[model samples]
Target: MPISPLRAEAPPMRVGLTPVFLDDQVSFLSRWRAWLEKKLERQVIFVQRGSYREIVELLLSGKLDFAWLCGYPYVRYRRQLKLVAVPLWRGRPLYRSYLIVPADDDQSRSLADLRGKVFAYSDPDSNSGYLYPQYLLTMQGENPSLFFARSFFTWAHRKVVEAVGVGLADGGAVDGYVWETLSETHPRLTAATRIIGRSGDLGYPPFVARADIPEAQLHLFRSALLEMATEPMGMELLESMRLDGFITGRPALYDEIARMAVRVGRL
Candidate 1:
């Protein structure tokens, strides 16, 4: 009689997240990791990349099974990635780019008014923190170099707020969602900054996987995320992350970012 073949164990799933949130939010991350591991019923490997570019590269290269990625990179590599889910912020999967300046400043009423001033950008790959603002300038025939006397990237949305609020930079671009959350938790840091301009509703970043992920695993991950709000532990995680819930997102949500890239000639 022939012996039955032995079944091989599947490898653990790898998940990558961009460093968009506060660095000290370790408790939430710990809970998130535990919840995901339990819900997925497979060993879950967690990875965090400080830069969106690195995280996206890992996801696209198939080194990461899933990633929480920025909308800008998502649109840039839409062909290579697939949407898993989008976070619901204030009941909708939309956010805005905020142009900010020192609260005491009376010279600027809008983003264009801050032309020729020093500017702080959050990150090169940030949608609300950089790309949308760059696109705004481009719409008026301006780019960062031409519109601002000098510009620098703070590399994080919270740092962008601090740079502008403390007068290190005359103005800055940042994520509105992050700004609001900071206002509530770290009032001292945001008290001296005022929003000068804001964009219309833009797509928020999303949880994504490679276009080549196995169908069964993809469904399991997506379903788990979509149902996170209903679970006790998941609810705590969502609250800590300032998310209302998760939803199945459409690729069209990122079309504006793609158009912005084209307008700025970065596509």
Candidate 2:
């Protein structure tokens, strides 16, 4: 018989992530990494960043092959990134920004009501958490920086909810998907806050690859995500994520976000 040689393991695929949607999901991320490695036949490394700025910086510097990024940042850097896949929520790759306040506060009915109040922002690059709210004020001829008496970065959507829920902030903006997910996973906490306003549907944050990433690696990673709804283990993962599935998303899906960015002069 002819002798066979051992094959070497490929280098790890570095993926960037922030705590925008995933606040403290260590176990789920571990399982997800295993699934991706199995599908791609390559080791995977998940890089955690405290903010989207770190993720975007690493990705742009070629230290990261891919990252899940908010639509606002994605649109701002669209020319430098390639869309990998978009997660489906309630059967669509769309979500909204939620304006929330304490449940007992019935005086607040809209964004205008929250002016001059303390606010919590998930991240400056966050579409639903920061950009949308800024655009809201900008379109109305209001200066966002001056509209709020004070604002702070919670860095995570869940934390934003906690801030408003505990009266730490009079109001806050958050990703509607994260808010909805919390309503399911931690009902008591979500119950403490009430949604006072909702923004127009925007592109769901998307997994993206560096513009120069090899096509083979990009395809494999995208396949691993898009097929998650079909396999048994994948279904379990999807259920835990409270997502429907992933789809090959078009760049145009974020056009509205880009337009909003232009309006806010963030472009």
Candidate 3:
């Protein structure tokens, strides 16, 4: 599908989705699209991108009407994008990041033990995958780059888990919600991974509409999402995404993420 122009007219609200790795997970995207079309009362389309940055750029440039964005990118571009809502996992407004190692590895037990070890981080714009992990490392009085012998970005939480599981890296950070979901649904992947430490809870990604979208349309969009978790089909779709509920969100809630970004010199 083309990156822009959802429809010639505005009858069927065109909603764009940015799945974490659309290129490799066509089935997942297909299922998500089908679910959205049936439940959201809109013509849903999935927009594949190389990274979170690309997705944020698309949203900021007015190429997409709405997007599901990570916390870091949302915070970075809040001035340009309006926060709509976010999926709540396990009835909480936030999730965490797990610093994981191989289940059998005995070399590391804490953040301090990881000194000089290799580390794998997810996309730079990820909250549970990157920001919180970086914050935790800094809290320990260790610079992430200096403490790790080598580091790289995986751009996906699953790849970070896989890297740690296969001993490709001594340790890495993965989204806690993703880890829990994978453990429950994909035992083979979870069986090989173990969490050694966890970062403080951080807000999950939010579904945002561009600042230029009409106020009435934005309200309608938010209303549709606010009631989604209660409807039968909406409940099923949330379950498929491993979400418990959806909550209204505002840009101010992410000020902490932006502060952290500045502290880490990422801003």
Candidate 4:
């Protein structure tokens, strides 16, 4: 009788994430992890943190194998990170920063109109949530620090919307994709706010691996993301996440974000 070969499983890979995407989708993460483990034939552990800074620190310290990071951080630390994939939103690797105000505030048309009002920023390290808005203020000859009556970081995009929705903030900066997605998942929260201004399209947040991670592991995860649109279960997940798919986006895709970072000079 021929002996059956043992199915070898690779060591677990740690993926870091902030609440920017997960929000209340706890079960979704479990299912997603199951899919990835099946694809890689290896254990996959997700490291969830409340803030991007925590995840970034873990990733840079070699504790995390991969992370889905905003364009701002990915560009700022490009040398230490390897771009693996960029999410597709609306069928393209692009999204925008939305400056939002309460639904009843029809008088405010742009960021300029919200001057000296309390503002909520998702995260200081966030592109759409902080850097782009800061750059816009700098370019317009205003100091971001002094432009608002007060400003605070919520550390998560969904929280930014929540802050503005309940009038805890007069205005807020948020990821366009997150806002639109919540419109479907949590319409009442979104209905309480309105997008008063939108930034020029920017690179969607990207999936990245630590530069020193094993090449085989990196390629496997990247391929899994890129191939997500091809299978039924993957497609369902994509739709649930409101993403079209993932692509091997170029570094130039984040040039605009890098420019914003440079202009803000806060990094």
Candidate 5:
């Protein structure tokens, strides 16, 4: 007798989120998860991790069916991920990088004036924090490594603010949204820093699904997100995350980020 062939099993949908909420406000994430679970009608689990880099790694490894990732990381992994949605900041789908210095420092007014000064970068992989600022510096005919006497990556926007506050570095580029959020909620840090300049706006971070996820399911996820800001439960979650709404997005939205990375040879 011939042996029967076995059928393949479909994998369950798995969603992953960065610790953006946890880092800024954990209470909000808890409420968000509860709301997401009810809205999706599925068991939604929140993966706790140390950094955004780790979240990216987990998603790339097929552990997550979908994820929310920063713009640069999403651009870097666009081949393996599908752009789903991105949040609008201050009524725009894009945000900028802020070159901040001590509130009392009046010596440096322009990028060129920072020559030989110490600088802090949120992270090497950060789009607004590192890449865009570097691009802006290049446009001004300055290389960060050559312009600054020393530089350091603090790995978090708050740390960048803290570093500047304590006079550890002369100044640094921080995500404008993060700066705004911190300034509004955490007055101590923002009080110590002042924005001296702003880089050109770039696409904000996005929600993405793995490339192989079923199209039907992706559509459902998108619909769910699009309605999140309206539902009472979801509205509370959005407020917790300091977001107004989620908007539809395209992969091409992040192409500039990839091009910048390639130009800087950091991709």
Candidate 6:
């Protein structure tokens, strides 16, 4: 038998993923790292940031090769960042924001009913967790600071659900997809929460890279994601996360969110 040589590793790629949608961070980090490495053929160095603003800054500074960022932040920095891909969740690159209250609380049928109660917001830069809610307040001519007796940012969608479920807050704004997935994966935890309202379809979050990445590499990265749904292993990974596949995104898809942000003074 002839001797075989070993294959060399590809150059490492620096990546950052938001913990916004992840409830089981350890498992998600492991699976995502493995999937990204295999697909991109690069050793990924996963970076951590506490908020979307920080992640955007890291990418803008050229410290991160790419990042998974919320739609709100993506639109905020679209001028400096380029969209690599957007996850198609349930067959569409769209999602919604949800306002949830305790399941047993029948009195609160709508957001207005929950006025004067404490509210939980996930992240300041979050469309589902904060922006959409603020937009709703503005549309209703309600002031968040005064409409709700108090409001706090929980930093994560799961935490927002937890806060509302545990009675720490009267209600919360959360990612509708996260809440639905959590209901299936962690039923007991979310059984106490009932969605009081939901926002219209909004652009899904995206995998973004610096606008200055080499043209060839940028195209390759986008292709890898768009083809993930056809690969058996990639398909499996997407299924586990309740994602349909990846799709190319346009800046116009996020115009509504931007409009909402401007209405709420976030833009």
Candidate 6: which stretches are off by over 4 Å? Answer: 1-10
Off by over 4 Å in 2: 1-7
Ranking by lDDT: 2, 4, 1, 6, 5, 3
- Which model scores highest in TM-score? 2
Model 6 poorest 10 in a row by lDDT: 1-10
| lDDT of candidate 1 over 54-154, digit per residue (tens) | 88888888999999887888999899999999999999999898899998897889888888889999889998888888898888787656888989988
Candidate 4 lDDT over 1-267, as tens digits, reads 111233465667789886557446877887787887778777778887778888888999999999999998899998999999998999999999999999988899889998999999999889999998899899999999999999999998998999999999999999999999999999998999999889999999999889899888888999999989999989998998999999998989999988888887865
- lDDT (tens digit, per residue) of candidate 2 on 166-209: 99999999999999999999999899999998998999999999
How many residue pairs collide in each prediction? 0, 0, 0, 1, 0, 0
What value does the lDDT take at residue 71 in candidate 1? 89
In candidate 3, stretches whose alpha carbon ends up further than 4 angstroms from where it belongs are 1-28, 38-42
lDDT of 4 at 82: 93
Candidate 6 pairs with clashing backbones: none
lDDT of 3 by residue, 126-151 (tens): 87777876877787777877878887
- Evaluate model 2: give its lDDT: 0.91
Steric clash count of candidate 4: 1
For model 5, residues 101-120, the per-residue Cα lDDT tens digits are: 88778787866777788999
How far does residue 165 in candidate 2 sit from its true spot (Å)?
Answer: 0.5
lDDT of each: 0.85, 0.91, 0.75, 0.88, 0.76, 0.84
TM-score on alpha carbons, each prediction: 0.93, 0.96, 0.88, 0.95, 0.88, 0.93
